[model samples]
Target: MRNSRPIILFPLLCFLSSTISILCEPNTLVCNEKEKHALLRFKKALSDPGNRLSSWSVNQDCCRWEAVRCNNVTGRVVELHLGNPYDGFDLEFYRKFKLGGEISPALLELEFLSYLNLSWNDFGGIPIPSFLGSMGSLRYLDLSYAGFGGLVPHQLGNLSTLRHLDLGDNSGLLYVENLGWISHLAFLKYLGMNGVDLHREVHWLESVSMLPSLSELHLSECELDSNMTSSLGTISEVHFTALSKLKVLWISGTSLSFHVNSSIPTSGSGRGFLSGIVDTAPNWFWKFASYIVWIDLSNNQISGDLSQVVLKNTFIDLSSNCFSGRLPRLSPNVRILNIAKFILGTDFPFHVQKMNGRSKLEVLDVGLCGA
Candidate 1:
């Protein structure tokens, strides 16, 4: 009788411990019904031929759906990453997988949504929905290479909390008449408008310089000209002085002939400058050149004596310019240097000899420079 009693008590204790363990576990939250319905409506508007949203079914929890991320605590959809997955330049892959059709206004229902990326998808040249500007909760928005056409909606300026905005590489289809709206994005860190036609925006520089927090600015192949450079000289001397946080600048292939003045302020911990045109290197540029890691002023009408300039950059490409006189002394950290198609004097061999001991120098192209 005593042995039977001990066995009964042991089983009871096991059951009690199991029940207590189950009770101590936290309850998992399900996706909000309203937000789930909004997501369904948003998906219904798009044509997903690739069936990328197959997981987004009615029976399943919307929180576990592909490209949709919900907050763990509140179960509110906070991010929608519907960008194309392909990263290469293959057009067939892009065409086969790209998401098309109109973006539904139902997205406005996601009150807490912040990150939205729809880059590299084919939208069939539709104008960017002006309603996106009203979604004030968005912090990271990327619509680059998405085949968006026509004028960019100025209402996007309302996204004061936006940190990164990329509308670049839309096949020259996107254009903006007035950039006054951009001045409102004071918190913007990265702004990319490459291949977007900005020939009409006369005050573009003035508006861009207002972003004191901007670290990377990409305006490549945007039809910017000498007129834009003139505006930059004036606005940059005043407004750009405040952009001390700026690090990477890419204004290549824009036919911009930069004329450096003494008044230009030495601001920013600049890392790269890919300005394709410059009449003379600014004094302020050399003052901060030591901090620059990459410099590319190639294929321009720049004619300057770089011999006096000490380039501490890791990569320097001053090729296809009218630079004359002796080659500039290479920094020990220089990895790739290309001064091709420019006369750097007959003492090129001497310069190469001086750089022989530097093991980091890998690519040296002084081709057709009267070497």
Candidate 2:
């Protein structure tokens, strides 16, 4: 008891001092000077009628600015998330929060910017800045639904470190005439180019094949032609082993040749039958699609059986297609099946029995299937 009181008091005092130090810390860390200037320059270039950028000012740290995130340790800008977050309650919110302006090249000053999302804004139909391609450290780049019109800068392919790139839904304005440059993105995993005009890109498939690390691909409504008829003959046997990492593929609304339940005849000397669509028919396609978790081939002219080749534990959408014959065999882990308007030529009783047994199917849309 002689010194216990003094020891307890000393420990309490140390704890209080540490607590006070942490509590007195600044609310937001100070951002880098050059990055702050770059952001201010970007604000000056934009027309923010809704005062969306009011928080951005010289009096405040740029790290605390709206749609900006900086690394706490280094005070370097790491993310710029500007524009309407599409929450789906209000589709027109993009119009309200749309920042209309010329994208300032001053953004190049943020050397550490790894994530930049300018989606759902209004850029006045300008071509995407080619300088963005020089940002080698960028991991996520999304300019979707931003009213960007004109040729997509081939320089974007220079982002070899990019993991996710979404330039989708620009209202048929963006076009990539040459896709060979995309081959340079060796580390790319996810790509969404929905609604972009790719009708003229004959080599899109071949170019995409070069990306060995691609896991998810979305090219819906791109107006791609069904010109793989000649190649289909040779494709069945050709080992597409390089696309082993593909997990999600969406080709809805494209004009690709899809063989449904019918077997595709091959012309080569060692000819064999191709069972179904490219997702399952070709030996390579089926092998690579083993890990596919999502697949949407809706609203296409595909006529195929839902049997042998469909991926397990996947959200499958084969609606509005010419898919006939037997109801596709639902995998044990199939979670959702949208087979609406699918003309499956199977007895109603047999189909219902199979559907009823799938306990994992959380959503089953078999509407308008002429069973």
Candidate 3:
């Protein structure tokens, strides 16, 4: 319940006794038999740290195993969770105990599966199979930090019931050839692909922006930049017109110099912009960009005062730029603004009083300014 993995395994004898007691009920017995197949497949895939899963002996029934949940009505295996089982294990120990293997294809056999968390594992370089998308009942799919690669399968679009999808920290996935696949997913509410590289599938960025149901989008390094400049180029007025409901967009990028092995100034509507962050501005932009609440151009050569900013919920940043002018008068609704290390002729407003009036203007990082 804490990490959302199953943690309820009773002793075999107790389970057997419980099963025997329930055997008299025909429906109960039938449900148990139906669930047995899924449970068997689950046993084959489990790799536990602390040898706790050793108790998941083939000799014993898995109905009593921890980290597995069955539907009481249908008696089907509906949950398979594997995450940080121990809160106190040191990093090295945790790594050793971590599970690593292909997500068994047999998972498709368990049609009732509703939730899964195979995140933070040492499962290196094992790509998620394409069949995973066909599991229409899957509501939660988390494959964070698995080091798996390959394009995110287009089949994932088939899961109309999916609500939470986290493919964070997966360096193995370098391309996204099927952007249209995810656009049809109207049910998805929370999407996380932090540190995922979209350069291989930049088209998906444009395609995914069309989803009307998307609310929370978390795409951090999605490339390599610590700043969120690379992601800016992906937004065209044509693509984001329907994203009226969107709230958060967090991309990552490098410093002002590309010193960190990233893009310096994103250019072209769809060409030079890096992955997660977008630093450079294309020559033209439509007025619809005013919809974005936050614009983080922290580490790039973005020149200009915050004058161009008009979004109400935004925290515009011009840090590490060549901007040289008076700090722009921020709207009362603005939140965070960073304009550090600029090659400018003006200075950070000495009054600091302009900031006190706005209730939402929380963080103001003006480091290394010439003011």
Candidate 4:
């Protein structure tokens, strides 16, 4: 009996040892060969002047390459974070490190790639590759400030899984004539097109409101005119009410007229315009003021007696506006308040006098006010 047990145990020990060796093997994991070749092809299409992608080589495992991420088990490339490391303001550093040349269609081969960021790079003002719309697995796509010009490809509407999309700040070069395609992004949560010309997209809001999942919307410097605002007013209240999940709304530096209603749900909201004409702040606008965390109606033609208005937001910027009479009462939680260039009377509002002790006021800018 003892001899038989030793023989059986001997075979089991050998099997365990072989399994351990296989698991412990170094450099056993490598990215899929097809995907690796795809990445190499994609890199070949780009001009990396700073050698930022120097590690991208056929000899090295593509999984180990810079700005490339792969699944731990499947070894499939899932993310490409080729965004410029330097800040946008650092022009010298950007010029030295930026990637240019055409974005190759090879990226379409990465069927598992879910995130792609090519922001802050220079692409020589070329149109965004329309083929990008075919990458169905993409959930996050950022091409902001990437020097892409001309019309934004409507084909991007095909990305039904996209949750975050930013095509902003191309120095006003990117423009979209129609946004009807945006309505196709059913699952989109954040949409940013700041500085992109949307002056021609008259039905923009209608397309935007179609996204029930949207939380953050940024359209600053889009050159939106009053016509869009008028169109917005025409949109049924049911459409605005559908944006219950919206938390951030920024439409600054345009010619948009600000109108508030019970349907608009927002935590951080700002409305800037070149010719926003509001004779008086609507009483209903104050109805949702308590839910707002930030409010900026600066540099507009808003005129009213805001003494009756009470702002509970943490930040309030009503500067460069034509608001007259006494200042609005600030809530105890208000931290930043700016009313520069207001026509409020020479006498300081009672709230401003009491702000020193009653509120959490930190940054107060009342400069150029009549007071």
Candidate 5:
């Protein structure tokens, strides 16, 4: 009865003040003037597709803009992804722009940037400069599926912080050599190089020995040679042994013999031992591989047992080459599998039965042995 209005109204006033403070916070995820201007410049440089970047208006806060990512803690823009296509032009419109242009260094101005994925863009003739590597904060750099050419500047090695590097499918990635230094990347989590000029030497893989934190590695279509094949001897024993954090492996290990239960296939080179050593090389390979689900050695000189290990969520491809082990029970979740040029000598001394569990199998082809 004694002026209850004052008590109710006082709390309401405090709640309203707190809301206004949050909205006007100086540390909010709003773009500063320089960042907004940088965004405007980028929009002008790109040929927007489906008006996707139409939302990139100057009135908008860049951190909230499309395809743009920001560091959640500091509220600073970090990633700028622009690659679709304009209304009228070659589907490769983005490709043409990379051929020749002044890369706005304004982007490098972002202080907290770490991951930059500029793939599928036609950036021809543009060079990966030393300044780009000095991005002391960068951890993942993916310049793949692009047309950039020229020697990979040695400065890239300076990015001591880089963890995942993908220079794949680039026409000129082969130009850079003496990459044993790249092994210096101690924090590398993933490294992919398809159609590049790195084979065997081992000094590079030896460099991997230095990276104790590495997790994933993909060296596809490298077209290995005798030296490269022999390098596997040191893979598990040396660098691979050090990868205590490794999880996935897509490698063709040393040739071994198989326990065939029937006549060997004539189409096969018959060099495979069918001794699944995927778990042998390094203890690390097997340790993390226990958690893997995807592995492919389809077109290679790989021969071994496919069912020796109980790999979960795996899609194994041991076609083309000679593989002589009996197909083991696979998880129903496996989707793709091929064992065409596969054979287990002339005797499978062990059992071959279906594994019991909730799985999803997609492909199963077994041929070439006694076929």
Candidate 6:
């Protein structure tokens, strides 16, 4: 009786152990059923004319679907890149893949999602979903050129872990009432809000400066305030001590009013005082020389001495402005220089020769400078 019982029990134990090992194997791991249903719900909300999400059907695993990424171990959705990837130089490819639909709030189901990109698509002028603020795990978000309308939702400030944000190039449909919310994103490094109206947001500069980790700021053509220079002087006194780690700064085509006191130098200084121009005064743009790599201050009504500020950038564009007086010498790292449509002095060639020898100076466009 004892020998018969041991034989039966040994076979049962071996069968249970083999079943447990098969269940725990990596090949058996599939996308979480809850998250998979969420993805299906998200697809249902959008009107994808291009059929970009055809592979997101029930026949396939969600992890193997287009624009979806899942954690290998936990099998949780972590990233979604639903942007029009073909919006580069290929016109045919762009027309084929561009999605036109509203972003769904169902994305909240993916609690572990860290990356989301929905740029270069047609969203039919819909407002960005406010619920995105609740996605606490988000690290990168890009909604550029998505055709969204209305004021930027203040709820986005709740994303304390966000590192990069791009809501730029949405035509004139998107804007900000104020930039106060941006101060909360302490880890934000790159902020691109180009072409969004900031005319009403007077505290734009100060609010942006509060971002300690900010490296690149692109606010070009954003209808910035006319009081930019005066605000910069004030900001320099207060936040310049805090210092900017900004590498790329683009404020071109924004109607910036340049009204500086006559105490500042307009002409070249040789340790000699001129009756007309101020001699040897510190300039605001000069302070940016050390930190910035690329700068574009072109196509504005900047009326002042061009030689007033010294910039040491790799790429500098001061074209189509009312800047007079001697040009500043280019730094050794200078590669592209555009100073077109300026009233350059007779000694403009001198600065050009100085750049030719020490710097990697290449594309120097002095067209219409009257040099």
Q: Write the per-residue lDDT of candidate 6 for residues 1-371, one digit (tens) a residue.
A: 85999899999999999999888876645798888998898888887767899999897889989999989889899999998988746877876777776677788999999999989887878898999999999999999988888889999999999999999999778888888999999999999998887766768877887898888888887875433333444334454434367788887877454334333334433221122321122366466544589888776545455454556788998786655566776667888889887643345332443543466877888887764
Candidate 3 has an lDDT of 0.60
TM-score of each: 0.79, 0.81, 0.69, 0.83, 0.68, 0.81
Q: Best by lDDT, which number?
A: 4
Judging by TM-score against the true structure, name the best candidate. 4
4 versus 5: better TM-score goes to: 4
Please give the CA lDDT of all the candidate structures. Answer: 0.77, 0.74, 0.60, 0.79, 0.58, 0.75
Query: What ordering of candidates by lDDT runs from best to worst?
Result: 4, 1, 6, 2, 3, 5
Collision pairs in model 4: none
The TM-score of predicted model 6 comes to: 0.81
- Clashing pairs for model 2 are 260-303, 260-304, 261-304, 306-328, 306-329
Runs in model 2 deviating more than 4 A are: 1-24, 86-92, 227-240, 258-290, 306-310, 343-358
Pairing residues by index, what is the TM-score of model 4?
0.83
lDDT of 6 at 353: 31
RMSD of 4: 5.5
Deviating ranges (above 4 Å) for candidate 1: 1-27, 227-236, 260-278, 294-299, 315-317, 327-330, 338-359, 365-371
TM-score leaderboard ranking: 4, 2, 6, 1, 3, 5
> CA shift at 225, candidate 2, in angstroms?
1.8
Cα misplacement distance, residue 343 of candidate 3 (Å) = 6.3
- Give the residue spans of candidate 6 off by over 4 A: 1-29, 88-91, 227-243, 258-282, 306-310, 343-353
Please count the clashing residue pairs in each candidate, in the order shown.
0, 5, 23, 0, 25, 0
Superposing all C-alpha atoms, what RMSD in Å does each candidate have to the true structure? Answer: 6.9, 6.2, 11.0, 5.5, 7.0, 7.7
Evaluate residue 130 in candidate 6 and report its C-alpha lDDT on the 0 to 100 scale.
93
